[model samples]
Target: MQLARIHHLLQVAILLAVMVLSIWLIGDVLMVVFAATLIAVILHNLAAMVERRTRLPYWLALSLVVVVLLAAIGGLGWSSGPAIAEQATRLRIALTTQAHSLRGQLNASTMGRTVLDYLPQSLGGNQAGGGDNGMGSRIAGSMTGVLSSAFGAAGTLAVILIAGLYFALSPALYVNGLLRLIPPGHRPAARTLLLVAGRTLWAWTAGQALDMLVVGILSGVGLWFIGVPLALALGVVAGMANFIPYIGAFIGAVPAILLGLSQGTREGLLVMALYAAIQFFEGNVMAPLIQRHAVQMPPGLTILSQTVFGTILGLPGLVLASPLTAALLAMMDRATPPLDEEDRV
Candidate 1:
């Protein structure tokens, strides 16, 4: 019996190793597919409600929901395109100017001169043919190659959309299939777990959407009032970044400050103050209210999970961390039974 148990342990370990390797190997596609599925799940309840209330066919309701979603995406993209383009142009110009100024300042200082002497050697590899420019070109080429490889999987977007539609349209079937894996006595409990997860996910999504809108509008308005160029674009970036929890606010601030600095020191200071206020409001007031209404995650656990998953999965990990954490909590709640009748009540 001991030998048999040891064999089972070894088998489990090998299986887990394989799973980890598979996840790492296909991390990019998996992230997009998971994101699509979660979005579909959030919209599932709305589609079902519309179908029932309007006495429309399931397919028709599904189509309506898809149309509305596509329209919203298109509208936002169309409206934001020009602002984003302008901001991109301005940001590039600002960064170039800053780099040149910094280089000049460095050249004037003894320490800077010493550092500059080593910079070219540090940047260039030992290859005789590869100078600094060649190294930079190679690095850029490698980045392009990596991006192309990551996105080159044929019809990936289509697959995600179709999978999302199917899941949204017939979530019950999926739930039933999952519940079938449980023991007979636990199937009901499994169903309850699914419901809890769905509710939590929906709540989290709603809160996130509201937070994004509020931040975006505030950032845009603040930038406009401060006379910062590319205010609209910066606002959009801030709003989008706000979805990622802790690190996002800082990332959004960098570009805003850079743009502000381009205007002058005074404008940069104003932008900094405005951004700080926005971060304060978001962290203290907005987050708590949203959490009360939606899924409540422990702040410490949220940060920890974000770090772990982000390390393994990159940007997508940060974006999906909260929802994934909520799902895990739901599972835990289901696994642990109530203490007593009083607790149940």
Candidate 2:
């Protein structure tokens, strides 16, 4: 029996090692698959709503939901592109001018002079008559890489859309199929857990969408009120970045502050304060209330699980962590035997 146990442990170790290697090898494809799964979950709810409201068939309702989502995304991108581009150009020019002024200011400072003395000879005080051509070249290279990645992402999104459509149309077929793999007695429990997970995911999706809209509108309006250029662009960025939870708010703030600096220190301070306030309200008020009503998670465990899974899985892990944790918690609640009041006493 001990030898059999040792063999089982060795087999489990080998399987885990293989799983890790496979994940590393196909990380990009896995990301696309995970994205498709999340979209399918969201689309399932939308399709169900449409089916109930109208007399449309399941396929037709699913198609309509997909089409509407695609149209909304396309419209937003098309409408915002020109303005975002113009803002980006203005911001770039401002950054260049700011960098030159900053270089001069730093050079005049005591610490700057001390640092310059220790700098490598190649990058030292070599100021050409023209602007920072090296910086320009680096920026161009980065843009090219970004464009390439975007094209790759577009292809991945197409796959995800197709997969999501199929999943949304007849999700019961998928659920029934999965349930068949479990023991007969456990199937009911499995169904319950699945329902819990779906409900939790839907609630999370609704809350996140609302949060993004609020943050984007507030940031854009605040920036405009403060007379900062590119307010809309900055707002859009903040809204999208908010999808990543804790880290995203700070990342979104950097560009806003830099743009504010172009106007003056006062503008920068105002923008910073506004963003800070928005985040505070969203975190303290919105998140707690929504999560409490929708899907409750233990605070300390949620943060720790996010950190651990995020380290292992990167951005996708971070994005899916909350829902995944909620699902696990739901399963535990269902599977554990309840204690009788007598036993508790």
Worst 10 residues of 2 by lDDT: 139-148
Local lDDT at 288 for model 1: 93
Model 1: residues with Cα > 4 Å off, grouped in runs? 1-22, 78-80, 96-150, 153-158, 181-186, 337-345
lDDT of 1 by residue, 17-83 (tens): 9978765666656666677668677668677778999999877887888899889988977987676
Q: Where does model 2 exceed 4 Å of error?
A: 1-28, 88-151, 183-185, 298-303, 337-345
Tell me, by TM-score, which candidate is best: 1
Prediction 1 TM-score vs. true: 0.76
Backbone clash pairs for candidate 1 read: none
